[model samples]
Target: MSIKLGIIGGGVMGEAILSRLIAQQVYRPDQVLVSDPQAQRREVLSQRYGVNVTSDNGVAAKADEVLLLAIKPQVFKAVASDLVSKDGNHSSASETLPMVISILAGVSLTELEAAFEHQPVIRAMPNTPATVGAGITAIAPGKTVTANHIEQAKTLLGAVGEVVEVSESLMDAVTGLSGSGPAYVAVMIEALADGGVAAGLPRAIASKLALSTVWGTAQLLQDKQIHPAQLKDQVTSPGGTTIAGIAELERSGFRSALIEAVQAAYRRSQQLGK
Candidate 1:
């Protein structure tokens, strides 16, 4: 049987995409294939998703129409070397080269094209929230990619959450923001929980409240389509406790700290690409 999708890794993010695609009925389990070096990982993915699994990347490269490159950036070159031959060519077994969508951080489209050689390549940055089918992925296409390729990429990724099309140049910023934003949000939740605990709430209750507040606030913002400042103004009455807390947060440079964190992460992402 011809494979519809080939996944190059079975790690958390890779599994997230695979599971989401299957769960959303984008692709059936038998239509997809996964390649992982670890025997345990291959077995787990096969058992969990009922997809064909292989230790050889070449099998994925040769068999599938579309490939999801979710391997770590550090091992990308080595993995690509295994897929292509010494002559810098893809397998002749497939009439056409596979369209590749890479979720590997800091791997540029140019680098992907160089490795794959004349194949369509898309660079995507998806956050950890994808594990829960709540990720927002930003994708940039290579020169050779067509409209159909972009649509296919979006269709597969959209299963997880939102899909945003961007130029390759802006990918690092996307990486810093959405790709790293979950950690920032997690920190904010922890801080909120800490504040509740300081005010005499039980740790478990505080944590639950903090998590729920964050989740609820996001849902409210998205559902209402209202600006955050508008919501803030609505909740913060004159001389109220909310206003007082807001004032303290402003005085403590909360917004500035988050901005700097993204900037720092962007710089780190750029360095990794080099």
Candidate 2:
């Protein structure tokens, strides 16, 4: 069965999802409804994808089976108030309320449910790379969500990239690890490129090598199914260059620094949600 999908914002992330959906033809453009206050953004979406666009949040909220709250967490309460007020007259329990999938970072399921009046809420953390259809999304369902709701969330998230299911309690950790993980990885890639440049490689070539190295290493980890330590050992001959660099990194406490960064992010997520 075809599902009606509603997007309740037209910011970068919301537009990214819309663009990917259109590019992938996951759903008919006409089936997607978007509401955003920004006229320019709405015009861009409507002109490019032929998706329905409106300034009224209620119009978007009422038009679809799956509603994505793509607005920022700071403004979410106001948006949720509007949705709940508009839903005041909706009384068909047999017809499920729209499955609310929120991509607002650090917003908990309880906060979402409370804001939207106990709607079936799925809180998801998707990274910025979703704009390129290369994101990892983590989904955590609220107490009111059903099995069908979870599957629906997965299907929608999977349209963009890989989707992982995690306990709502662990969602903060996911936010720290994967949601904010891209920036950390980007920093490492930049540092690697800098090192290549310092080693006399041209800047352009060094960048390409750094990115490819990271990508290839990730693929090896996934495809080889060997532990990362084993892979490192395989690359590091006794007293070899690889081992020397690894020793430097170990001395610099790279692993410990990463661990602390993730923990900090997790704590920040928890604070933001509260």
Candidate 3:
């Protein structure tokens, strides 16, 4: 039997994608190959998922079907060297090498294509919420990538949540909004909980309220196809408590602060790519 999916990197995000794929039965455990540097991680993945696990990046990189690069950007150079090395003896040796789909932040398609040389490469930005199948991922495909390749990437990525295709030019913006957006939302949740405590609610209940409110509101917006402004207007009866809070939020520059945070994150992502 052939390994249909090869995963490089066995960290949190890697495991999140792996577990979801397996849970959805998109690929059987036997068809997956996971590579990690640590023996303990390799052992755990093998035992838990019954997938083939190895320390050789080359083995995973040369997988027969799709290859996922879940490694950190910092280690990509070392890993790429190993994958592309002449001594590896796998370079150009087969025509069935997998298309590369990368979730490595700050790694560009140009760099991925330069390393793989011949395979279709896709750069993906996925948020932390993907761990629970509530997140969204934006993918940018390389020049060699076709409609079929995009669909393939989407099928795999969709197991975790939603997958959207965007232009490479908009990836940085996607990074700013969705990639780092979770942290911003987490902060908002925290602050909302704190505000509830300040208003005399118990800490635990306040936390739950904050989390549920955000989650439900997002679901409602999507379900109703309503704009956020429409939701706000619907909730904010003239001269009511909701409008009172909205006025305070506007005065405190809440919207501008979030906007600037995204801009800053976008700039930082650009810097890292350089």
Candidate 4:
């Protein structure tokens, strides 16, 4: 509605949020500002979204009421330094600082608060599906955040996908599950395609079938609000091919492998945070 949002990176995730916000009419392109170190990226986003773009992170940070930190975690410290004064406070002389929402992976609220010097911070973990407006994001707020701050954060993130509020302690689990889930689903799709090819289908047809099956099954489960097991049982008859396939999957420990994968990712996320 107004020119009040600033994003610190113009990368894929950053641009995804920007595009979705505009598509949802939550914010207009002219109302949003973005910053990227790459001049080409800045120009591209400006041309693509009609949003103001600058090479100066501080300029974007100072110009907005809400700041979205979409920069890579490895470069967060350097970028943050540009937004703060020598005393580690917002460089602006104004008493109030912008509410910050960060999508940087493995960065905890404690680290963000420290970097921004006690600014209200919301840490969000959103996966790649957000690029297409089908993502789910988990958000955790810092100690200084208020109810209003939470609403603001949700409104911004909800433009792209579903939002879940979680305690900071469970963020690593969220990171493991939905945050890294797209890769797991992609692997599953590829394996399904390969299986179909092994059974004598053309590669292109196999790939399309696998992708559509996954998409349809997901839609069905969501639309019906039924457990996956219920759906599996519905398709598995006493002597049907589905049961034969199910047996093979069980024999291969498919479910357990997925569970272990999520657990491994959770542990890795914790390690990265440390």
C-alpha lDDT of all candidate models, in order? 0.89, 0.84, 0.90, 0.89
User: Judged by lDDT against the true structure, how good is candidate 4?
Assistant: 0.89
Model 1, CA-based lDDT: 0.89
- Per-residue lDDT, model 2, residue 202, is 100
Q: Is candidate 1 or candidate 2 better by lDDT?
A: 1
Q: After superposition, how far is residue 242 of candidate 2 from its true place, in Å?
A: 0.6
Candidate 2 matches the true fold with a TM-score of: 0.93
lDDT of 2 by residue, 1-274 (tens): 2338888998988888888877878778989989999899889989988998889888777645788889978898888777667763133556556888999887777787776654688989888888888888988888888899988888788777889988989989998998889989999999999999999999999999999999999989989898988998899999789989998999999999999999999999889877
**Per-residue accuracy of model 3 over 88-121 as CA lDDT, tens digit each:** 4136624656889999988889888888877889
Comparison by lDDT, 3 against 4, better one: 3
Error of 3 at 122 (Å): 0.8
What tens-digit string does per-residue lDDT give for candidate 1 at 110-172?
889888776788999999998999999999999988999999899999989999999999988
lDDT by residue (tens digit), candidate 4, 106-187: 9889889888764788999998999999999999989889999999888999988999999999999998999989999999
Give the top-scoring candidate (TM-score): 3
Clashing pairs in 4: none
TM-score of 4: 0.95
* Superposed model 4: Cα runs more than 4 Å off: 86-94
Candidate 3 vs candidate 4, TM-score winner: 3
TM-score of 3: 0.97
For candidate 2, what is the lDDT? 0.84
Task: Please tell me which predicted candidate would have the highest lDDT against the true structure.
Answer: 3
